[model samples]
Target chain A: MLQYVLKRLGIAILVAVTVSMITFSMIYLSGDPAIALAGETATQEDIQNIRRVYGYDQPIVVQYANWLWNALQGDFGQSHYLKKPVADVIFERLPTTMLLGACALIFALVLSIPLGVVAAVRPNSLIDRIALTIAVVGQAMPSFWFALTMMLWLGIYWRLLPISGTASWANFVMPSIALGYYITPAVMRLTRAGMLEVLSSDYIRTARAKGLRPMTVLFKHALRNAIIPVVSLAAVQFGFMLGGSIVIETIFAVNGLGFLAWESIQRADLPMMQAIVLVLSFFYIILTFLADMLNAWLDPRIRVM
Target chain B: MAERVLEVEDLCVEIPIPSGMLRPVQHVSFHVGQGETLAIVGESGCGKSLTSLAIMDLLPSKAKRRAERLVLDGDALTGMTERQMADIRGNQMSMIFQEPMTSLNPAYTIGNQLTEAMLRHKSVSLAEAKDRAVWLLEKVGITAARSRLGQYPHQLSGGLRQRVMIAMALMCGPDMIIADEPTTALDVTIQAQILHLLAELQDEFHMGMILITHDLGVVARVADRVAVMYAGQFVETGTAAQIFDSPTHPYTQGLLECIPIPGKTERGAHLGSIPGIVPSLVGEIRGCHFAGRCPYVHEACTAEDVSLRPSLDAGHEYRCVLSPQAAIANRNKQAAQ
Candidate 1:
């Protein structure tokens, strides 16, 4: 087990390095950061001075190496758009996005798993049809569009929820719904397929023959076996949710790293953009690694490797 | 005489097909007396498993059943809701299926699977359930039952898993057990052990058992009465001795002849063979469903449908147009030559 943990950690470090390099290189690809930082009205000397001040006058490799070295020491440089430390800007916004992602994940599982199980147990029934319809609709609508529509119906029309901004726990309701709706279909479909397969297995028949109630057979026996695949899918989905909150956060005007990243991109704030990209990428990698470990724990066959 | 424990009468199961309708089981009737072992013998798709499922009311909802009566210990089972069926299944009439490897849930420990029925039917605490589970494990011949109870299904071998299934089935002390080809998936040695264990358990518990299998050897070893099925109908049924020694139906004769014994002649030396497969149940049949493959096929055999009638013995019965005396005479003449 120790060896396995170490091996997984080694793989995670390699993944993190690859993500960092890609994010850093992409930020530099726009070229001539000095001109962009100095702005259109600035003289050539001012541009050169700005380049010197930001160390953009150095070689691209040297700049990337220095940026990476500073990042390792917890220095993300100053945000060009926020006019504050990039790390401080990110730290303030991290909680809201985490909360939104966590709530959406919980909602998706709580709704989709039972729906999928019912649908699978009684295929072609009314409940099954309803679940299938929900899955189709959930997959059809984009997150941003869903968020806007929720905002319109609940915020503007009914005045039941805040239209934009994350202020309190209640404020997370609409954004979480949008995020949950987008992800629910994947969970529902995976759960439905997995449940159907497990339901047909011989053990379920054995459980039924054991005089277990249908609910016990389903929830305790069938669902436990069915959930193995769903756990892995849920893990990947959760990781995606953590990283894919950008569009939903932007639409809701939630003060999150995603929103900050969008604002940084608009102003061409290189350091802050690079920092946000690196941080989000790092988050995605970490979550995926955690998901892999969780999956291994859930299924012993996987742990054999 | 043993007391009658289960009686299934006129049980029919119609499955809807895209092209037409199919009756997988039609008016199949059988019963098991207390502590009696009845074997429903048939090749694949002969409705043996369907009959077992119907008795338990475990058939899928798509299957349409029209049974005159299905009584277990004088309790009616027909038309009961799934919840009610759940109450009776493990408590009164439990079942063990073929493929032990797949029959036990892999995610759960043997102890958990074993105690599930006990917890479900009886008001037992966790400690009581666990104790019962360990006891059952030991009863089924698993060593260190307490320790092995924590092991998963996949951790056990096929034979051990089969023993676990038996342990689970008998955990509730059910009055009857429907073992559908219980030994078919195991090796010869394990199969023998399981069959012996079943016989011993049946005696110890005084439980009526219905063993469904295609193996004549299994029927000879365990069955008191045997029902031979063909094309969703009973072709022949009698005491195991009568069915093996004096098979009345042509299909049963052919099936017995097909079994190869030690020191038997080389293959294809006039060895018996049933010429055709069982007919599909899609369309209606005017005459005997087995007439196409019966060596005694005559115009009358295919001209009208045949129903089960008693042979020479009161309990011995078969579904055929031929007289029992004639069949016995013909079989004797063939054996003599």
Candidate 2:
């Protein structure tokens, strides 16, 4: 197991490096970085000074090497607009994003799994129809619209909860729901399909024949095997949630990494944008890698494969 | 005391299809006595497995089951609630299914599944359950029984997994065991070994067993009595010797003839086979279910249902129109004339 993890870590480093290379090049792909950094109204000498200071005169490979070496030493340079370290800017808002993401995931799984299981238990029943309808609605309707509706109904009309800001739990209710609603369908549908398949397997029949309690048969014998693929799907969805939080964050005024990312892009803060992209990509790759390993551990057959 | 383990009468299972209801097992009746091994023999799709599932009350939720009576240990199972049925299922009776490759859960260790029923049905401690699991495993001839407990189903070979399944069935010391084609997926050698183990264990525990198989050789060896099933009903039933030596129903005769007798028949002799198709189960079945497939099928045979009639022997019985001896004589006389 240790060897397996070490091998995966090696591959993860290579993937992270590749991601960094791409995000770094993306900023350079647009108009001259020196002009963008100096502003459109800057004089020619100012543009030259900015270019020389940032080593834009160096060859592309040399420039990339310099940035990469500095990045390894925890220096992604200062954000042009904020005049602060890119890491400090993104990190300041990390906790809020993490809290929102975690709560949304918990909410999605807690509600969706049972719904999926109920639907699978009695396919085409009234409950099954209700779950499918909810899944379809969740997948089809945009979260921004859903967010606005929640804001109108719960915030403005009922005054049950606060509309904006992440000051307290009451304020968090709308944003979490808006973000979590989008992925509920995927988790629910996968659970239902997985449960359906597992419920028919011979082991399930054996479990029934053994006279296990109905709940025990469904949850213990059936759900464990059913949740294998769902785990990987959950990890992928979590990563998407991290990246997808941008729009929801902007709407809710949750000052998080996603909102920072949006600010960095609009202001063309190249280093800040580069740092956010690199960090998010690193998280995505690490999550997928961990999911794969967890999957192998869940089912030994995959290890051999 | 004449101990009766299981008794079923007029048990039927019907599933709803696009065209309507399909009766896979219709009006099936049988009884199992203590220390008895009744072999239910039939070809594929003959509803043998379906009968066992119906008895276990584990039939597919969509399929409907009806029975005049289903009793186990004098307890009527016909009207029992699912909870009541579950209480008796692994406690008083259990099932050993075919295909050991899939019968055991891959996610669980052998010990966990084996100890489950014992723990559920009896007030046993965890340590006691583990001990019983080890004992049962050793009883089924699995070496290093305690160590095998930690292994998953896929970690073991097919034969070993089957042994584990058999041991699992024996965990609670059930009064009855329904083994549906227990050795069908095993190699011939392993098949013999497993059957031997089952027979030995059954005798030791005095457990009534229903062995369902399509192999005549398996029936001839371990069965005390044999019931030949065809398309959801029994065509013939008698002592093992009587069913083999004097098969009255054409279906039973054809099934016996299909088995090659190595020492009796010539080496190059053409193996016997019954031609034609098994009648469909859909729509109302008005006659013998095997009439269309029987070589001696007369118009009278297909006109109405034929129920079981007693043979000359005190206990032997078969479902047919002709008397046992008369049917054999009539066929012989036809050849002479």
Task: Output the number of the lDDT-best candidate.
Answer: 2
Give one digit per residue, the lDDT tens place, for model 1 in B1-337: 7989999899999889897888889889888999999999999998999989888877887788889988999988987888888899889899999999899877777887888789889998989989988888888899998999777777889999999999889988999999999999999989999999999999999999999999988999999999999999998999999999899898898888888765765565666678888888986887899987877889988888899999998799999888999988877776566
lDDT of 1: 0.86
- Which residue runs of candidate 2 sit more than 4 Å off their true CA positions? A38-48, A293-297, A300-305, B330-337
Clashing pairs in 1: none
- What are the runs in model 1 whose C-alpha is more than 4 Å off? A1-7, A31-69, A81-83, A303-305, B264-270, B332-337
Estimate, for each residue in B220-319, the C-alpha lDDT of model 2 and write its tens digit: 9999999999988898889999888777788887777788887977788777788987778876888778877877778888788899889878678888
Docking class of 2: medium
Q: How good is model 1 by TM-score?
A: 0.92
Give per-residue lDDT, candidate 1, residue A70: 91
